[model samples]
Target chain A: MDLLRFITAGSVDDGKSTLIGRLLYDSKSILADQLAALEKQSKNKEDGEIDLALLTDGLRAEREQGITIDVAYKYFSTPRRKFIIADAPGHIQYTRNMVTGASNASLIIILVDARNGVVEQTRRHSIIASLLNIPHVVVAINKMDLVDYSQDRYNNIVIDYAEIARTLGLKDVTYLPISALKGDNIVEKSTSIPWYEGPALLELLETVQLEKDIDLERGRLGVQYVIRPQSNDLDLHDYRGYAGKIASGIYRKGDKITVLPAGLTSRIKTIEVGGKEVDEAFAPQSVVVQLEDDIDISRGDLLVNGDHLPQVEQEFEVLLCWMDTKTLAAGNKYLVQLGSRTVRGLVKEIEYKVDVNTLERQPAPAQVGLNDIVKATIRTATPLPFDRYTDLSVGGGVILIDETSYVTVGACMVQ
Target chain B: MSKEHNYQLDYLDQLESEAIHILREVAGQFERPALLFSGGKDSITLVHLALKAFRPGKFPFPLVHIDTGHNFPEALDFRDALADSIGEKLIVRKVEDTIQKRQLTEPGGKFASRNALQTFTLLDTIEEFGFDACIGGARRDEEKARAKERIFSVRDEFGGWDPKRQRPELWNIYNGRIRKGENVRAFPISNWTELDIWNYIRREKIDLPSIYFSHDREVIDFEGQWVAVSPFIRLDATDVVETRRVRYRTVGDMTCTAAVESSASGIDDIIREITATRTSERGETRIDDKVSEAAMEDRKKNGYF
Candidate 1:
């Protein structure tokens, strides 16, 4: 079965949690014991009915405070596909959580309450998803139940979101009217809305193609370890292979490759998985590849096919999301870890801050505080082999680390 | 070169690859490392990934189990069997030994659990072995506080976790650095959820303890958790026990681990149950965590995995 990772982003009252609860419940994906526990807890609540929001609100603090503080993951599957849904927080302060959730997802589902149309958080999440290059976006105009399943209400949200999607350069945007609370247009087609013609949310999730979501042609590999068996026997002596997961692309025997950092060149001699030799390996596969030359390859170095080289540079511009309370100032040094390599970097300049609501950019202020979005230039101590964030999602992102405390202060999408 | 293997790789294969990459980084970045094997499905999964990470040779580090001295007998046997099969060194440190040595105190009463007590033994073992990196099979989805933990989480010299001071783990280039007496707990399966663990166990065909499958065992319904009838358990006047077909969602201390009544006898059945369960695996199995809102966060702050 195919795997599809998607992120759900919405405001507190937009019924994001209810949608997930209904999806799991309607599909019979929920266990009896869990439902029993929820029912028991719901009985104690003021509503005296099963609060579907209690399903994704796993933390006691979240249930007590009625807010999601961190990203909560929910798993469910139909016959065609298995999904890992990142239930990210919709509050502006929790925007970092949204980025973290959508960072590895193939698709993003932005829930817009049909009654509210397109709100600010909706635009903010859509922008981040686009900035993160989430391949597909499904704007589920939720709470059609509140709007009496009105086609006009859903159409308004679609039109409002379309303008924002165009400004964000988002492709493959699909709109659907859904009622996560009452289970309309969620698992199966809604019989109440005769004017709608689109497939149900679950059906779209099952059939949406993800062939181009991930890069499979760059053939990039980051060496994680060098393995050598200790034996004096002549036949087995000096057997060394560099092992790692293919971060992107594919490789085969006799494929010309270059090792990064040292820039050494070699040809792939063999690829082995569990002592058995294979002729080829590709992205995300854990295999040990032996090279013809005994190059000085070690951890922290990347191996890529020789013909296609990522940009090697010391300075690059990034669309950064400042996560920590401390403000970002010029001349501040942070550890930038990209792929397997970590280098000291200095913030050289702040280009501008982004206005999430109006889809506009403003002049850079003196500092970028927590939850602030800005474009900045950072210079690394050593050159890094990277692709523009737009070109390669895997190679272009960097996490800023505070040197004194070693805390990840911010995340940057390299431009 | 041999002909292309052309083997069909599944989602588990991708997850395993990511884990192996993380494991190799730990091996390379740290001066001393150890794998925290609990003989449970998740930790065992980590061991399998480590074996594949450094194949054609023995493991680069020893496997350590912070034994609570209350584990299922079958799980302990399985742990030993796995170590022997892989030709890797196994280090077992028991909480009972710590209590007997007066290094730690045990909670009194039949309902008491040694779940929190394991932290002392784990920290002691890390110091005794001088291990800088302790790799575990903890997944973020298992608990709320864990969900906030960084994959390469840093612990202070006292083996306490300061959530506010956590290192930022971005991408796969994990930084494993610390001052003297400080250590890092590396969770390779941080992304894998409960269902992923079951699916991986099925896909790899890895052997697990018999208790994971349905079997007739004496159990008592205690405070919404299924307590197995054991010598350590204290049967209250009101508590009644009977034999039931049950399986463990999580393997923990005997005093704390709970079993669920189910007729699911195999991995496939367990996977199906896991898929359908709304309550978290820990919610049903972990008695220690049910005590408070910050139960996990509090324990993790004190260096418990």
Candidate 2:
């Protein structure tokens, strides 16, 4: 079966959690024991109805506080495809969690309560989907039952979102009207609104196109681990090999490749996946490659096609998403882990912080705190192989870990 | 050499790459790391991936198995054989040793399981070795509370999991840094499901304990599930032992593990059976999980693997 990974982004009252719970419930994915547990924990069910929101709220703190503090991943599959949903908590301060969810998401479901139309939270989520380059956007106009299944309100909200989508450059956006609480137009088409026509929420999810979401034009592999036997015997077939997941593009035997930061060149001699010889290997497959020449290579080294080499530079512009409680100021050193390489880097300047709500650029703030996204330039102690985050999602991403705490303080996208 | 490249990935291949990536990160980041090998399919796959990650060289860390003493003999034998073949250091910490010290008590009466007692031995082993990182083969698809787990899960100095305070893991980067006394439990296969594990095992042709395949085992019908009759189990007078053609959907200590009535005698048959099965892998085999919905969560908080 095919797999689709998506994210659910909305506020507590926007029915984001309820939509996820409904998808699982209607899909027959919720097992008997889990449902029973849900029933047992739900103390204040209205008119003895099961509260679906309790299903996604896995943590005690989340249930007690009635909010999702971090991204909680949920999985379900229909006959056609498997789905991994990054259920990101919806709060202004929790924007980082949404980015975390969107990082790997192919599609993002921005739940807009029909009663409220396209609110600021809707725009904030949209901008994030654009910033992170989530390929498809499903604007589920939820709570249509509360609005008496009015198509005009849904149409107007769709119109409002269309303008924002155009402005934010959201590649693909599909609109659906439904009541997650009542299971309307979620799994099955809603007869209550005969005037509206669109694929059901679940159908859209299963078949949404992510073919072009991850680019594969330029081949790049960051050497994760090298396969070298300390003592070699003829029986061991102990040829020098480099093991890594292909970051982007395709690699085949006999292709001449360049190693970044060191610029060593060699031809691919053989390819092996899980110790079985394969003719070729492509993006994301963990394969071991042996080169024709005995070249010095190690972890933190990049292997790329000579014709499609990535930029090797010491300093560059990056969009930094601050993840730590500690404020990010100018000249604060951090360990930058980009691809397979981790090197010490300092935030040279605070360019500007984006106001996630207004989609406005806040220029040159003195310092930035938790959940802040900024565009800044950083200098590394060692050079790194670079590609713009827009070009290759896998190769261009970096995480900033605090030097003292070793905690990931920022998620940086190369610009 | 000029053949067209294929971007399509066999789903299992994607899972394998992700796992290998996580394993390398563990070896690189941790000062002292150990792979939690139970000789089960998941842990076995972990060792296989570690071989792919740091093969041709000694494993960056040792192999740790918390022996319940109620384990299937086949599992122990396979565990020993696999480690010896792989040339990795294997550390066995037994519950029997912990029980001998009177630090843990063996429960009495029917429904008593040594499964829960393994937690104490695990925490004690972690402390004894001062292992800062423990790599596990836990999959999120196994249990509910685990579904919310991060790839790089941090535990306190006492090895407690704080679900509320877990660091948000994004993209492929895992935050493995922890304080002096704390440790990180890195699950490389957290995204893999039961079917994924079986499919991977089949593709890789990895060896498993014989209990996974259908065999005639003396068992008792306990709580509506067929359970292996082990010496440590307290059987009541009403219980009847019968040899049933059964296979385990999961591998744990024989005391707490249940088997399904199946004739899936090989890896292919097991995969087919799993495709047709509706209940979860853990839901079918692990009776300990049925104590309460959050039993796994509560145990994990108390440092259970």
Model 2 chain B worst lDDT run, 10 consecutive residues: B1-10
> What DockQ does each candidate score versus the true complex, computed on alpha carbons?
0.47, 0.51
Q: What's model 2's lDDT at B20?
A: 86
Whole-model alpha-carbon lDDT for candidate 2: 0.84
Model 2 regions more than 4 Å off: A44-48, A235-238, B1-6, B51-58, B84-88, B127-130, B240-245, B263-278
Predicted structure with the largest TM-score when compared to the true one = 2
Classify candidate 1 by CAPRI docking class: acceptable
- Recovery fraction of native interface contacts for candidate 2: 0.42
Residue B8 error, candidate 1, Å: 8.2
Candidate number of the best lDDT: 2
- Residue pairs with colliding backbones in model 1 are A30-B276, A31-B276, A219-A249, A408-B168
- Per-candidate TM-score against the hidden true structure: 0.92, 0.94
Residue-level lDDT tens digits of model 1 in A1-415: 6678898888668988888888888888666656766786673455465777777776656777887767776777777877778888888887777787778788899999888898888888898888889999999988888889898887877888899988889999999988887788999899987789999999999999876766777878877778888768675587788888787787888999988867879999889875678777777687898889987887668888747798888999999988888899988999888866788999999989997656589999898898788999999999888888888888888888788766678889999
Q: What is the lDDT of residue A88 in candidate 1?
A: 81
